[model samples]
Target: MDSDDLGLFGPGSVTWKVHEEPILIVAGLRSLYLQSLHPRAMAGVAQNSNYRSDAWGRLVRTATYVGTTIYGTTAEAEAAGLRVRRRHARLRATDLFTGEEFRVDDPELLRWVHVTEVESFLDTARRAGLPLTADEIDGYYTEQRRSAALVGLDPATVPGTAAEVADYYRRIRPELRMTREAAETALFLTAPPIPWKLSLPARIGLNLGPPRWAYFGIAGTALALLPAWARRMYGGLGLPTTALSADLSVRALRLTLATLPRRWREGPLQQAAKERAARLAGTPA
Candidate 1:
């Protein structure tokens, strides 16, 4: 069978391995924190998106887009990409600092979003004690170039290795800062609106005070996982996390998430992708 007829990344691909893990929820959070440091990109989100009122919806949509691109059939992936490109084409935002209008589809801004996400996903997986080699890590980045292309980025121009990612961060550091919108975004991620099903229990826990503290604790762990320089940008917005504590927290969380039942940890999309790959390999499914 053609590779496209199989899942986009297939079973052997590092993208599949990294994304299939439940720990990626943390990675997704880390990516958002890192992305918020970019004023223009963050402005586009603040001005044009309903992230404040519908934070969970925004997260679900982003996860869906990623799931479709990485595990869906080729046609499905392309269609999703087209939808995003069309939406971006019509959206415009004014930079808060510069007071200049710009298209959301601007390649530079797209690149910023793309690089931060890919780096976050990979770095989180590794730091969480996922066993990935140097070459495998590089391979994962190389594979993700296909993902970047779907969102209108040129794969060749995007960083495809750890060294390149570090250099990209160094070059882009000057453009990043902590703004009011960014600080607000961080707070939102920390204590987002709870889903209705758990509202009563959550309220009870909140009344007892443990839930609020636990929520901030989890949020702090997510923030601590960010690169040192990125964490520094947040400045006085929150308490600083030492590298040693961050490492222990990530590893412990990964270990805890690993104990979840396979059915609970692997979503239907991921299970279907694995079955597709098995069939393509002529193995029992």
Candidate 2:
């Protein structure tokens, strides 16, 4: 790690604070739920993804990409992004609705994935008791356009603020739906196949009992955190109190995770980046 390199965000950036929170695990899942609602996005994943067979590996790789963008050196981040772009360049998905095979990496589909992802991170952090003001929230979105750019999106074409994201969602609502792909994806996320091997704590820890239900809780919490409108698309029309429950659940989840030792909570990438930031701050010209 280059102690002097602050990556894309540096220490002062809002993104550094927002993405560090453990609650963003829920946020990542929320983004998947939200992104799947787009027909093209769902089709792309349903057709091209191997998430079902390699669920944990897929999750780790996704997390690594996100962490690299936030914490790795600029070159590392760019390299990771380039790898993704090349992979996506080769993949195509056939959307039955469009009756055509389209590149999965199209800007429009990428934009939807990008927007929903950042929105979920911002929303989840705030709801889990992070103290971000309105301007900071806007700044987070503005800063994330750099992330959008790395994935081959034109920064100017992506939403740059919370207001813009909200408006974009409203305009795109008509195109969003719970298609067969999205439905199956959502079902799998709620109860994803667990890897047969697990340590002792994972088996009975978290007080959630079985591993399956434990993961279901995590997924359900993410589902609960979805915007009510998105929830409705998935037949989550039960009650208005779901919002309150989600808020409570997220807060509790964050609190529980916080109890663990720092090493347990913070991954190597995050720790290395923060150390670099601190090292640079302590040195003089």
Candidate 3:
């Protein structure tokens, strides 16, 4: 397919159904927490990312890149992927524990980031009551290989089924660890600085109380929603989340967020994608 054709995945794809939901805010946090378990990946981020000083900015940028790749036109998605690749080419980092140097674009590191993010998104949406079937879950992973390819990973090498994902995790577990950098990244993920605009209202709402407490609550809940094995990696920090509690919390949060009007909940890119789909189907947009 041409890069200028309709984006990678179409409207009926599982990716659209999952990515369109608001619960992905939680998924994003979960992905970051999971990604930090890899020492080299954490070291690269600590050395190169401005996550501490401009956490929200970094998040917005990451969200934009994801949104573009998922919802933008094929040309746009490819362009965005090229930009990321260009940036990665110039970046390098040393493993904090092993004192080994590696490029940011190393395929192994890229695969780690890709699997964690897609798995997080799928898991969060499923728990939040998105109503995906077993087949759809597998299809979602298969579809995401296009996304992997965009970032320079060979699709054949990326996991494209639930079973493959499980096996990938098993093979990679030996390399995962809770390094000091990972712990600090976890802390930062839990309570990064609130944006100035949000901080002003938060200050007024509770008489200058740190708004981070509210975020901590949400992050704690997100952490609880993680799979048991993933949560156990953090040892005592996992917050004692049971499957029942996680299910209830996710459902409640999904319902609450659903109350917002469509215009408020849907981003411009998603809205545009819907309209384009409608037009393609010869229906009212």
Candidate 4:
């Protein structure tokens, strides 16, 4: 379904005022990436016939990341992380979440879905702590166009026309406030103005290519293992500082798995992995 159909938020709407706008936006973008990648890991979890019901249980937990990481206290965020992870472990390898039995096969539709989610994601990042500049926001839009190509959509056909693109933004305008002007203002207020600089290591980490063929499971493994020190190291290297947060780490796994190859990973494998992981950890299965 198109994000425009969600009607989740409104203009100038900040999910959590306590978190800086930029951080929240980044969090949102990260969340979108995870969502885009969900099918990958689903294979590792959907092994049982009842996988969908189990997955729904897990999503309810993962959704909490949006609340605790961006709005609640640190303790709350940490707690939520545990809850999501615990539920994730319950997924069955042979089963699928309640809805789709596979990742969307249409490349164009996937690209459009990715773009919409990324916009909302940036909105979340803005709320968390990103003091993005107009140039940076424009850059993000440009990059999304490129990313659309990665998933198999013609950039030229995307949005079809400037009017279409504008309409897309207008539809989500209610949930966002970091307009071209506001983003510019935030950038100007920072100690450094346009022509921003990112350290070499930071750039490397931030641009780290997507996972190998093992994306579905490995990403979740990496995220589940993410500790405060890991986040610090990644942050020190130049990724968004919030990327190190526990909530983000857990989410990274949840969404990545969802984007797996439909034939091999979509159903049973996804569920089995979740249950297997939980069993290994002796949590619950």
Considering every candidate listed, which one attains the maximal lDDT?
2
Tens digit of lDDT per residue, candidate 3, span 41-113?
A: 8988999988899988888999999999998899989999999999998999998777888999999999999
What order do you get sorting by lDDT, best first?
A: 2, 3, 1, 4
Alpha carbon lDDT at 114, candidate 2: 95
Question: Which of candidates 1 and 2 reaches a greater lDDT?
Answer: 2
Clashing pairs in 1: none
Q: What pairs collide in candidate 3? A: none
Local error of candidate 3 at 106, Å?
A: 0.5
TM-score of 4: 0.28
Q: What does each candidate score in C-alpha RMSD?
A: 2.5, 3.0, 2.4, 22.4
- Pick the winner on lDDT between candidates 1 and 4: 1
Q: How do all models score by TM-score?
A: 0.92, 0.94, 0.93, 0.28
Q: Which of candidates 2 and 4 is the stronger one according to TM-score? A: 2
The CA lDDT of each predicted structure is: 0.85, 0.89, 0.87, 0.38
Q: Write the per-residue lDDT of candidate 1 for residues 1-285, one digit (tens) a residue.
A: 434375457778999888877878888898999999999999998889988788888889999889888888888788899999999999999987678999999999999999999998898888888899989989998999998888888899999998999999999999999899999999889888776665787656645357666667768877888888888798733334476687788889888889999898887777777777777788885
Candidate 2 regions with alpha-carbon error over 4 angstroms: 199-208, 283-285
Question: Considering only N, C-alpha and C atoms within 3 Å, which residue pairs clash in candidate 2?
Answer: none
Which lDDT tens digits does candidate 2 get at residues 1-285? 455778899889999989879889999999999999999898898898889999889999999999999999888889999999999999998988968999999999999999999999999999998999999999999999999999999999999988999999999999999898899989988877666565444677633347666778889889988988998999995467998898899999999988989898888888888888878888532
